[model samples]
Target: MSHSKSFSLQKIINYIGGTLIFFGVTYFVYSNWLSLNDFFKIFSTLGVALAAYIVGALLYLNKEYDEVGSVFLMIAGLILPVGIFIAFKLTELITGINNLSVVSFSISLVAFLLIFFYFGRIILLLFTIIFASLLFFAVMELITTKLNYFFDDLIAYQLVVLGSSYILLGYYFDLIKKYNLTGSLYFFGVLFILSGSYFLSGILSFDSTLWKMIVGVIILLSFILSVPLQSKSFLYFGAIFLVLFLVDLSRRLTPFFGEAGWPLILISLGFLFILMGSLIFHMQKKIKK
Candidate 1:
C-alpha cells in the first residue's frame, strides 16, 4: 500500500512539474516571439523538445527515476507537435490549415507510438491517442474542404465510427490490464457515441422514428454492457442519455398530443425513471457481487 501510494504521489508531482515547465516555456516564447530571430524561434521549440526527449531517454534507463523521466517525455510529447508545425510553417511547406496539420500529427503519432513500443511507457500511449485523434480530425477536415463532400450527418457518422473503434480499443486495453487507458478511452467512446446518436436522432432537426429506435437500442446496450465491462461510466452515461432522450421525446410529442397529453408524458416519464433507477440499483448490486 505504501509503495503504491508513493508511486502515485510521485507520478502526480512529476506531471505537475512537467505541466509547469511546458507552460512556462510557452509563455517565455510567446513573450519573446517578436524579439527573437527566425533561428531562435525555431530552436526555442524544437530545441527544447529534443533536449527534453534525450534527457527523458537517459533518465528512463534508471528504474527509480522512470516517473521523472516520463515527465520529460511528456514535455517532449506536448512540444513536439508545435515544433513540427512551426518548422513546417517557417519552411513555407504549409500555406494554410490544410494537409500540413495531418502530416504533423501523423509524425507525432508515429513517434510516440514507436517510443511507447520501445520503452513500454504508458504515458507515451496518451500522446499516441491524442495525436491519432488530431490526425483523424485533420483528415476529416481535409476531406470536407477538398472534396466538398460535407453532407448531412456526415460528421455524426464519423463520430459514431470513431466512437465504436474507441470502445473496442478500450476493451482491448482492459484485457491487457491497462485500466487507466481503458477508462479514458471508454469515457470518450461513450461520449462520442451518445453525442453523435443524439444528433442523428433528429433532436435538433426533423423527427425520425428509425433514428429514435436506434438510439434507444444503443442506450439499452450501454446499460447491459456496463455489468459485463464492470464500467460505471457506461451505466451512468446510459442513464444520462436516457433522460435526455425522454425529455426530447416528450417535447416532440407535446404538439401532437396537445396540453392534455403533457400530464401523461410527465407521469409516464416519472414511472420510467423510477423503474430505471430500481433496475440500475440492482445492476450495481450484482456488479459488486
Candidate 2:
C-alpha cells in the first residue's frame, strides 16, 4: 500500500472506532443516568475497556506500531475485567470482614503496588499511591467510627485527594507527551477540578469565608498552569471555576457590603471572566500561530 493510502485508511479506522467507543460510553452512562453511585462503577469499567480496545484497534489499523498497540489493547482487556471483579469482591469482603477498615487499606495497598509494577510509569504510580492513601484514610475512618475533623469534611478530603491525583497525572502527560495519553490526562484533570470544587463546597458548609478564598486562589492558579500547557478545555473550565469562586466570596462577605456586595461581586466576576477569556483566546492563537 502507498504511504498516503495507508494513512488515509488508518484515519478512517480511527474515526469509525472512536465514534463506536463514544457511543458505547454514552450508552453505558445513559443507561444508569440519575444514579451516579450505581452507574459509575459499571460505566468506568466497561467504558474504559471499550476505549482501550478502540485505541488499540486504531493503532493496529494505522500500522504505525502494531506491537505497542497490541500491548495497550491487551492491557486494557485484562485490566477492565479484573478490576471490576476485584471491586465486586472487595465490596463483598468489606461487608463480611469484622475489621473492614483494615481490609480496605490492605486491598487498596495491594492494588497500588500492582499498578506500579504493571504500569511502570511514575505518573500512574503516583496516582495509584494517592488513590491508595485516600482509601486507607477512608478505611481508618470506618474502623474508628469517628466522623471527626476529616470525616466531617468529606468534600474537602475528596477534593484534595482527587485534585492532587489529577495534578500528578497532568505532570505525567507533560513528561510523556503522547497524544492519546495526554488527552486522557487532560480529561482527568478537568474532572478532578470539577469534583474538587464540589468537595470544597461541602467542606465549607455555610462557613464559606475561608474555604471560598482558598478555592478561589486554587482555581486561579489552575487556570494559569493550564494556559501554558495548551489545555484550552481546562483553561476554560478554570475560568468557570473562577466565577464560582468569586460568587462564593461575595456571598460570604455580604454582611460587610450589604446589598451592594452582590452587584459588586458580579461586576468583579465579569471582569475576571473577560480577562481569563482573553488570555485563553490569545494563548490558543499563539499556539496555532
Candidate 3:
C-alpha cells in the first residue's frame, strides 16, 4: 500500500514539477518581453524546448524515471510550436508563404513525427496528429480562399473526407495493437463524420434530399460497422445521430402528414427504438464474448 502510494506521489511530483518549469519559463519570457531583443525572444522558446526535450530523452534511458521523462517530453512538445511560430514571425517568413499556419504546422508535424519514430512515444505521436490536423485545416482554408471555390457545404465535404481518413488510420493502428491511440482516432473520426453529415442534411432548412439520404446511409453503416469493429463509440454516436435524423425527418414531414399521422409516426418510431435497443444489447453481448 505504501509503495503504491509512493509511486502515485512520485508521479504527481514529476508532473507538477514539469508543469511548473514550463510555466515558469513562459512567465519569465512574458515578463521580460519588452526588454528582450527579437533574437532573445525567438531563441528563448526554442532553447527551452530543446533543453526540455534533451533532458527528457536522457531521462527516458533510465526505466525508473521514464514516466517523469515523458512529462518533460510533453512540455517540449507543447512549447516547440510556440517557438516555431515566434521564429517564423521574427524571420518574416510569413510574407513569403501563402499560408504561414500551414507551413509552420507542416514543419511541426514532421519534427514531432521524427521524434516519435526515434523515441517510440505515444505523446509525440499525439503532437504529430495535432499538427497534422492543423496543417489540414490551414491548407483547406488556403485552398478555399485562394481559389474562391468554397461553396456552403465545402467544409462539410472536407470533414467527411477527413473523418474517413482518420477511421482508416485508426484501423491501421489497431492492426499494430496501438489501442490507446486508436480510441482517440475512432472518437474524433465518428464525431467529424456525424457532425458533417448532420450539417449536410439541412436539418433546419430541408435544403438537400440527397444529403439526407446520405446521412441515413451513414447512420446505418455506423450501426453495421459497430458489431464488426466492437466499437461502442460507433454504436453510441450512430444512435445519437439516428435520433437527430429522425427528429429532423419528423419535423419536415409534419405539414405533409397532418395531425392524424403524428401518433402513427410516434408509435412506429417507438417500436423502431425498441428493436434497435434489442439489437444493440445483443451486439454488445456478442462483442463481450
Best by TM-score: 1
Local accuracy of candidate 3 as per-residue lDDT tens digits, 89-125: 8788775343667777887788778878877878788
Please, what is the whole-model Cα lDDT of each candidate in the order they appear?
A: 0.86, 0.58, 0.82
lDDT of 2 by residue, 1-289 (tens): 9988987788567556655654665565567655657346644664576567567556666555664455445445334443444345545633533244445445545644564465454433444554465565656566546444345666556556665666676767678764235545565666566656556564324555456556667666766766566676566667666666556556666778787877777787788778877887776674422
| Candidate 1 clashing pairs, residues 3+ apart or interchain | none
Per-candidate TM-scores read 0.92, 0.53, 0.85
Q: Please give, for residues 1-289, the per-residue lDDT of candidate 1 as tens digits.
A: 6988988988898899999999998998899999988788889998899889889988988998898899999999999888888888887887776667887898889888888888887888888888998898888888888987867887787788888889999999989886478877888898889889888888744467788889989999999998998877788899999999889888777787776789989999999999999998988876633
Give the clash total for candidate 1: 0
lDDT ranking of the models: 1, 3, 2
lDDT of 1 at 129: 84
Worst 10 residues of 1 by lDDT: 203-212
Our model 3 lands, by Cα RMSD against the true structure, at 2.9
- Evaluated against the true structure, the overall lDDT of model 2 is 0.58
Off by more than 4 A, model 2: 1-150, 176-180, 201-208, 253-268, 286-289
For model 3, the stretches where C-alpha displacement exceeds 4 angstroms are 2-37, 96-98, 261-264
Comparing 1 with 3 on lDDT, the higher-scoring candidate is 1
